[model samples]
Target: MAMLTIKDLNVYYGVIQAIKGISFEVNEGEVIALIGANGAGKTTILHTITGLITPKAGSIDFEGNDLVKIPAHKIVSLGMAHVPEGRRIFAELTVLENLKMGAYTRSDKKEMENTLEMIYKRFPRLKERKNQIAGTLSGGEQQMLAMGRALMSHPRIILMDEPSMGLSPLFVSEIFDIIREISESGTTVLLVEQNAKKALSIADRAYVLETGNIVLSGDAKELMNDDSVKKAYLGE
Candidate 1:
């Protein structure tokens, strides 16, 4: 079954439409990349899916539930987590505190502890800086913390926006590797990126959006090899 399904979604900022009735589905355990340039409504789509922006039309269904009507915090409790474009870690808080905030909706202490340990194991850098303020960490470390905090919620699907933005090439590769690892560990991922080549390389499937509409979509390898995609996004 598809993990998340969006049907004829139209999102508007007042009278100005940002998403023009786009639609897609994300299957369980898949890494689905939404690649487009800035202002193509990529981030808008993520925001709409996570209930941060109310859609002007259409439906958002996750795990077979109608998510369009749910509140943002309620949506998170229903197993979807969103890591927005910016690494929005709490700068003033300790790393541990930020992680704890992610689990605010959960009550299972044992499971929370297990998840925390898993996050620490996955990003040992976070463990080393557990007591340090988030603002003190380097960019790459802060990105790791953002991801780790999202994982603390034990979400079934994660929506990531421009996770590679502003990182060095090495860190960019590392971030994608971690995304793959996270997907393999049972969380489906829907990724939005301006770094089209890198996003398509790791994605199981990809969708190309232009001016808020889907212009192309297919298996990642096929999209990567497409002449137009190569010219436009791959710098060929």
Candidate 2:
């Protein structure tokens, strides 16, 4: 069964239709990339799936439950974690405190601590700066912290939006590597990225979105080698 599924989703911002009817699925342990240019409605798809925005029509099912009918906070408790765009960490909180906040839905202290240790193991920089204020960290460090915080929820599926935005090339590589690691460790990933090259490189499958619609989708490697994708997205 697919880990998450969306069927004929439609969303709007008042009178402006931000996402036309679109559908996709993320299977268990797969890294599915939704690659699109700015304003292509990739993020809107994610927001609707995570309940930040209600879809005008369609069904978003995660593990047999309709996400559209559920509340946002309840979605996370259902083992779905969203690492939103811009690394929305609490600026004033310490790194460790921010991580703790990610696990607020849980009450098992021992399990939360174990999850924290796992996060530290994955991003050692977060462990080093555990006591430092979140806003004071460098861009790469902050991104890692954001990812680490998301993993603290022990989610079965992780939704990441523009994780490589505003980072050096080295950090972009690092973040993508970590994304692969996250998937290999049994978490299904639904990634929305502007960097088509990097996104396609690691994705099991990819969808191309243009102006609020999915224009194409196929094996990531096949999309990478396509003439149109090379011309428009890869700068080939």
Candidate 3:
């Protein structure tokens, strides 16, 4: 069933429309990707869904709740986690401290510890440097910390923006592997990435955006094989 649904989404910055009547759905346990070049408004869709940006017109439904009416902080408590484009962990905070902040919606100490343990098992480097300052970590490690922090929310669905950006090839590969593992373990993902190839590889379905509109969408593998998708996004 659809865990998240966006219908006729129209968003704008002042008078400039950033997303124009786009619609999509993410089913439970599915990894859905939105791929486009920079300025394509892919991130805008995520921001709108996560309640960081209110739409000029649209309806965002998360498990029957109207996301547009909900506050951003309350959205996190509703089992939605966003790992933003910049890995926006608190720079001065310790790694553990940043992670603890993600669980602010929760009150159960024992459950929190269990979640922390799961996060550490998934990102062992984080466990190794739990007390280290977040800003001191390498780019890839910072990315890991950001993801770990999101997982600490125990979300049913995750919205990831530019997850593989600014990483070495090896680290990118590692990050993608973990993303697939996360999906396999049953957390639905809505990924926005300029790296179309990587995004489509792990996604069950994909939407192609261009200049504030969804130009195409379908099963991930079919889009990967499409001539236009190959030429425009796959660099073939």
Off by over 4 Å in 3: none
Quote the lDDT for 212 in model 1: 91
Clashing pairs in 3: none
Candidate 2 least-lDDT 10 residues: 1-10
- Determine the backbone clash count of candidate 3: 0
Q: Candidate 1, clashing residue pairs?
A: none
TM-score of each: 0.98, 0.98, 0.99
lDDT per residue for candidate 1 within 34-151, as digits (tens), equals 9988899999999888888999899998987888898888988898888888889999999999999989899999999999999999999999999999999999999999999989
Deviation of model 1 at 162, angstroms: 0.5
When summed lDDT is taken over every stretch of 10 residues in candidate 1, the lowest stretch is 64-73
Error of 2 at 153 (Å): 0.3
**Per-residue lDDT of candidate 3, residues 129-213 (tens digit):** 9999999999999999999999999999999999999999999999999999999988999999999999999999999999999
Point to the candidate with the largest lDDT: 3
Model 2 CA deviation exceeding 4 Å by range: none
Global fold similarity of model 1 (TM-score) = 0.98
